[model samples]
Target: MLNNNLTWKTSPCSHSEWSQSDLVRGSRILYSQQWTLITDSNDHKSIRTVLPPGPCVPVSGEVLSGLSGHQLLEIWDRHGLRKCLNLTALNKHGRVYDDAQFGCLSWSECENKLLYVAEKIKNTSIEKHDGESPCRKPQQDRSVYCEDWGESLTNKSVPVICVVNLQSGSISVLQGVPHDVSPGQALWAPSSQSVFLVGWYHEPFRLGLRFCSNQRLSGDNLSVSCPRLSPDGSTLFYLQGRVFGPHNQCLSLQQVHYLYLLVVFRLLCSGFPSSLIFFVFVVASSAGFYDLPDYGSWKLLTVQKDLMVVCCSSPNTPPTLRVGFLPSAGETVTWQTLQQPVMTFDFHWTVLDVTTPPEEDNTHYSGLDFGAVLVKPSRPPIEAKTPLVVFIHGGPHSQFPAEWNCTTAGLAKLGFAVLMVNYRGSTGFGQDSILSLIGQIGSQDVKDVQTAVRTALQRDIALDPNRLAVIGGSHGGFLSCHLVGQYPEFYRACAARNPVINAATLLGTSDIVDCVGIQYSYDQIPTAEALAAMLEKSPITHAAQIKAPVLLMLGGRDRRVSPHQGLELYKALKSRASPVRLLWFPEDGHSLSRVDTQADCFLNTVLWLHQHL
Candidate 1:
């Protein structure tokens, strides 16, 4: 059923994910961003490429560009669309990685060589004769299972560093990387004689590294990444964070100076705070800039000489590009607009500070404060009371900032107030805040959200208390299920996308099994006592108390929280004769991020909430 009073129309702007390939030389800038548009049902839409105005010139006389897809490694001249070389044999070992985590296509200082990461070829084939090429041999067993980095990196494991000589068109894997470690974020050392990369140890086992940054590495007290060398080749700069505890935390800048046969690392600075979730970057002294009052977020695009390009946006504003002139000494920097936002929405948002009252038994949570971003229409749709939607973010460790979010804004445009809760354990607050949520998942996070909602309602906001609903994914989904179950009468409706229902079952089934242990503050090696503890803390324990209608949207192939988790809850709710529904996407993963799947999920959610509320 459709809402007849509401109008539906396609958006005027296109959605895109920017690649980290920004390059600048003289007055020219080069970058690549990708977006998908379903032009027709036949999928025969022509592809187009857009570049900055002027001839397609490389950074230097000739830029070395590379592309890895469809089992092919291609090198181009960047200008004139000339193909320099194609290496089809290399992918026979393993597919080349082009993602931000483990992928790299870096050129050496001399520009004659390129470095990248790829999966190591499995040695599961039996050679017919001695010294036979592994690629030429037939595989005797295809069932030899290999553990990967988990979640979004399902196909990635054992990433090896590979370098290619452009002049000779020859590729070879570099040696001397520790056998027990998986390498990523590779780059050429300033000397160009050696390589630098971050290595994750397979010592105990590999965990999902996608949303997690504090995974235990081989080195103690030192987790490093994004290695950059100084101009003189005698110093190395990188971002360093703790090697233990919560998955997402703040990182600081550190540097290492090189001498003959000796190297010393010293911290340049520490405790750089950010309001953004899981902030990670490398910075210099003058890299700091004032956060413009009107802009929700600003991203540095590229720099050329004394000028830098930046992109800024907010909840209601699309991205706008600006060029800033770098000032010398103490002079103020000046900025000029290069591209204005193409569209705007009739919505407004504010960051609310939510504080919890003192709990005598749990003094750690007493006076604990968090934040939430509320998005609503500029003008209320009805003089009476408008419906409100409480939106919870997934990562118990993630924070929600006042940045542009299409889904949140779309819900607001539909005349519903949206509240994005950053909960107590969310990142950017400090180390103690993150640790506070461990062993206190269900109780602490749930109380904070309920308190935030109560606080929001007490304000002069025109939201209907009787027409309230809840929606979330992953950990947020877990919270959503907990809310409707424990406080069964508060919410009118609920939606959970790939939520965690039973922590005990998740310990055995989830790829990131460590999450269960860390969140519950238990040992990973399961026992009867541990399992009992997990079951007691799960949302399913309160299933009998749930009266609110639940809409469970799950991905069949989710590697994070298995689809079985959602199915179990569906069965529990259905058996009780509750108004429960489940929508399954077989090809989707934990994120349900495919364009078509996302559209269907949100549309169905709107229909479900509208019908029930």
Candidate 2:
């Protein structure tokens, strides 16, 4: 007999209800920053804290990547000192942790080896100017995009993959991977010695997955993202921004066997997916499947017998541990939701649609489906149509996951309905949709945002089309400003944090230089026509048309988009006597409105909406 006496309930999400420390980012946001605890399997109740040497707390730092079960590993930066620890016995730091950067962390299959990526720390012998400020000048030879070089945050770091054996305490740096390639998201295969790596290769600057064996990176490769090996070590799962499929004989690419692989190798699209689409494939056979959730973060917690412990979540909920029964020959597959440490599912989710033009409109366009979400407030709005706050995520390449977000919850507390748009080129969707924004940035993206607003007004009775405000950071900021300008009548007010204003002006000064050309379709050196095209595609071009008051929040230490990008937009609007405000965070980098500044940004945006919208 089956019992059915349960229903889900939604609660009022108090923006200021939870403590700051209690609030956590979605799983992907944490990456490898927070402590990962494992419930003792024997008791299934007692928890084990993965602590570092001396039981020090991780402050103002994040974990580099994935965690393996056998032993605990962590990297923390506190008081300008960075430390990487394993089982309290392994600890390594640079002469100065302030300049050190760490990439993803992975455990070898044998449970005795650790693989990670980091920037080689330079000597700590440099003298500060005037013996006071440690502010250093830009290194001319560094790569333009800081993100491409994930190891170093201040500027692109010279990234390298290193492996350490726990038994003998021996460490070896990978020499086979070329100097020009920035390696990231590395994991050990079932063989233990063989590692799969995602590298941002230079020359044309594209991303690809490579195989390494016996300390050598092999030439055989596949352009892939979020590559993962299944527990039995016979299948590989990954998502390509726009592509996929499979066939009969075992063919090897990057030393990994693929029975029937149909690969139309395209240049690696720009930006890693902020969210991921899960795809699983049989390594020894010719079969592949790509039909998992297109939005959210999934992490394999633990595997036992025939049961797989996994945690999955979207923006609306925190990561919940769940149990999945591996598929048998003919038995029905089952998954059970496990309890989460914290409970924060307080809002309601609604579906939204954005119109897409026909293929003849643009051949390179590859968005099979485009969907947005409208999150309503706990209490009904005073007016028939609730005031709306549309949020645009940055990374024209990135997507906003459905996981719990404090910032959005806080705004909803102020009685505003939030709309998140996964516009063209947004990650989580396949590669085709991700690359759709490459050549059609300003117009295509602008149209998509408008379509979302129209869809909300038509479908969601809770949204007030006339009384709307827009908020975003980075590329999101770029679009927020564009929305205020091109569709000036739609948004009442705008708040852009570290926005991209003039791409032509930002090309040389910004760190992600290749990104401008690659995403915007320009040459390394802009000709007169390229400059004109860049200006035309830039949001600043429509500055004169924007009637809304805009709030600008810029990170002074940002290396990716540079504060100048925000400053340029601020000054351009101010020149026309348009209402604007610029707030700067000196200690923060590109991710200004994250941990320390998130609350302030949320509050300020709410206040700005109240005063303007």
Candidate 3:
């Protein structure tokens, strides 16, 4: 039995030091500073300065000193003044910043570059820079291109590519091979100069790499998550599957013996026609069983060369990351565990952060504390110190389990501390919390997450609140959007994948609306007025208020939330000039399954956070 009164403590097994300051840094920093600051730079005059001094870099080649905190100052310089921008301004004199704007300013060396795949959603032709019209007009069979290009990287054509221009919102299609292929995983190499396209065609999977500069195919082979290039792009590593069975002689002998037994059985039973037939049948069946071959679980398939490292996982295991020489098969191939163990945190039957435990035994979950299980980190302390990622599980009625999820585990492996919150309305804590969600979709449930965040911050101050991100699929996605819109200050970024943005739209589009109506006792579905009221509590209605950068992922075939849910909110946010991004997977339904699609979504998410958050 678990102790009910024990106060929750940070995971005792974790080697990393815990600090409250680290966790509360975002909120505390915001509170400690004066809401406004006025700086005078003309006379080298003094003013409040919490600004760290290091690089004297100018913004747009303009330096704006003596600027007030949380207040935007527009000074005339050759270009623009260099000053930190905030999401909100305290006064009308302050320049209100648009979070949605992807400014022309570049920060780090990698700031301006990103690689993504684009497919044609509508039949519309857009002209290319070369004075050629490559876009196909909307029809049933619109051309979809998979190309590798970013603002910083040069464009290249490949055997397979998809291109979407952010500036024009236009899509282009490019195909290398005539054969039809479904992309399994699309990864932009760390250099952001090339892309690796993985797809499944026929029986075996294949991988192809395309360099952006030349639009040339580097290499391709039969495998899943294969042809992984190193950060430097020197080597490729992949996993291969091989089956071992009976030796040739053994197989041949078994065949011969089975044939002999069939003849003998028939001959022996010949005395009685009916008995002979049955016995012969039994003998043949038994002989056939003996001829069955043996097989084994997928073994680590690794190809090592001087230039690259290639490794792959058995379909049963989660995708694994491997390191080796760049571009060539290396002499050594190292497999790194990409999944963390799941931990279950149960708190007062109201909230839980279900997650995978760390890989090592050094992490322990002694007694039940607040119904929250502390997932231990597998990597070293440096990796464990990565930003915390809280997953808001969907299912207003479902609970996030401590089971292994590709998304959670993948994010964890990408140096993120993942917390899957099973707040009010989640199942498994009993029917109470689940039922509590009926009319309290955004209220109490949201509170559960708020409490969990506080609890987590209490345990580890290093948890960068500024770097914190939330991701949710479906209902969880709804929660994510709602959280950002309602409490934009709490999160740095949000990814609402296949989320339900509008309750009314969901009531209309969901297949389970009829069932929901009966449970909630609403008549004739909520009226448009009632629906609007409910939507007022929805993220879609509040999309304009979200201050953090948001990413919205949608599936064209999703019936539960409807792609319109995402589209409507995305459009609203874009119109309001809120920082927002949208990614639509056309061939996919509600959740992504294709390996390539999954990989692309995951990779893009990490990259997005890396850039903005």
Candidate of highest lDDT: 1
Q: Candidate 3's residue-wise lDDT over 1-613, tens digit each?
A: 0000111122101011111112223211111101111233552122222222122221232212234554322323347543332212322122221111111111112433222332223324343333212233334334554332221111222222333233333322333322334332344433443344443331121111211011112123212233344434444443332111100001100111111222112212211111111110000111111111111112222232221111223211332222222222332222222222123222111124432223311122212122332232345255335477778876565555544355665665555667677664565554334444555566666666766776776676656666778888877888888888888888888888888877766665653332122233223556667776567667777777798888888877665557898999888888879888898888766665445566667888888777776
Query: Over 4 Å off in model 3, which ranges?
Result: 1-385, 514-525
Q: Taking the tens digit of each residue's C-alpha lDDT, what string does model 2 give over 90-189?
A: 3232211122122556766656667776554332444333311111213442333433332124443445556666566655555444445555566665
Model 1 ranges with Cα > 4 A deviation? 1-70, 82-84, 90-92, 124-138, 231-233, 260-288, 302-306, 328-330, 360-362, 516-524
**What is the overall TM-score of model 3 with all chains considered together?**
0.41
Model 2: residues with Cα > 4 Å off, grouped in runs: 1-152, 159-304, 312-316, 327-334, 340-346, 357-369, 382-384, 514-523
Against the reference, the lDDT scores of all candidates come to: 0.70, 0.57, 0.44
lDDT of 3: 0.44
